[model samples]
Target: MEPHLVTDERLRRVLDDLIRREPLFHRPEFGTTRADFAAMTASDFWETGASEQRYDRAYVLDALEERHQDPPVEEWETSEFSCRELAADVYLLTYTLVLDGRMSRRATIWQQDPDGWKVVYHQGTVVQGS
Candidate 1:
């Protein structure tokens, strides 16, 4: 396999790690704090949710907090992991999330910082059925 392909597989593993550890970061009862999000995202990050758009890191944190306040949805399957290197140590990871028998397209950009990989942006668009 080519070197970039190898790197992509490795990055895919990182995403897998995130999903497998959702009880830590994405669960409500775990009580993930805003400071934890601050550490996970870039300073200027933004994200699009199922119903709202947050244009900066603070707004993103607010959105996350709001979501965490609600009961968690633990039944979801993620597939189609694709990664593209955007720049040195920056990459885009895209996948499909299926929940409630509905699909959503999701994308997240991760930047490799000195501390670790921080998500700089993310978007999740619901796939409407005909």
Candidate 2:
């Protein structure tokens, strides 16, 4: 079976769902490997590597989860999405999350193939003190 030919919009939706609908605390994408299923299966922040070498996903989530703060809404907003760096099967997506009315500094990267798009890497930063 072939994967769906996902557009840049669909790709963003997938990530939005992952962040909005799931237990995930945060997410972001890096400029490293998103092709390895093992890498994707596990979170990146738990591993060890240089700031430029490691692209961890779980680490970002932990950061968010650590934030005991509350927002008016917990849903994420698609501030901007671009595929200018995407190749045929690989692409990068940057998202700004807004939860409970508070804006979250989060970014994510997605990979597409015969299996559609999956969360490869994600990082959430604090854009505001809220």
Candidate 3:
């Protein structure tokens, strides 16, 4: 069976908000629960300038806690994003995150459940040229 693809204004709005300044992931005090995970699977993440990476529920929570000193929000621009269906209820969204004149390719997989859209996977990779 083919996975169901999703393309809705509401979903885009929500995703845009999450990637904007003061995103939930950067908030140390933000609450993250198991509901955000898919079967407690450890998500993959690659932060800019990081040589190695590990991301899971606890890892993300701890990282947020350690990021208590929030940096001043930089002016950022995001390119048009595209989405594809990965499974019955899972969708993969890919876009470019532009900050400080640098662009990073960002991809996130979200799953819809009774609790709404939950991010099951996310990754950001620095783009070298063009």
Q: In candidate 3, where is summed lDDT lowest over 10 consecutive residues?
A: 33-42
**Clash totals for all models, in order?**
0, 17, 0
Backbone clash total for model 2 is 17
Candidate 1 lDDT tens digits, 42-86? 888887776765577787678677776775666667776667778
Q: Pick the candidate with the highest TM-score.
A: 1
The C-alpha stretches of model 3 lying farther than 4 A from their native spots are 1-52, 68-71
| Total clashes in model 1, counting residue pairs 3 or more apart in sequence or in different chains | 0
**Cand. 2 TM to true fold:** 0.43
- Candidate 3's C-alpha lDDT? 0.54
Between the candidate structures 2 and 3, which one is better when assessed by lDDT?
Answer: 3
* Candidate closer to the true structure by TM-score (higher is better), 1 or 3: 1
lDDT (Cα atoms) of all candidates against the true structure: 0.68, 0.44, 0.54
lDDT (Cα, tens digit) per residue for candidate 3, span 1-130: 9344455664576445444422225432333333322232334432332234655566665554455445446666777566666787676686777767677777776666665556666677777533
Q: Which regions of candidate 2 deviate over 4 angstroms? A: 1-76
**Best-fitting candidate, measured by lDDT?**
1
Model 2, range 1-130, lDDT digits (tens) per residue? 9333334565565445444422233233421223333344433333222233444555544434344344223455545433323555555555455555555544445555465455555555656544
Error of 3 at 42 (Å): 8.7
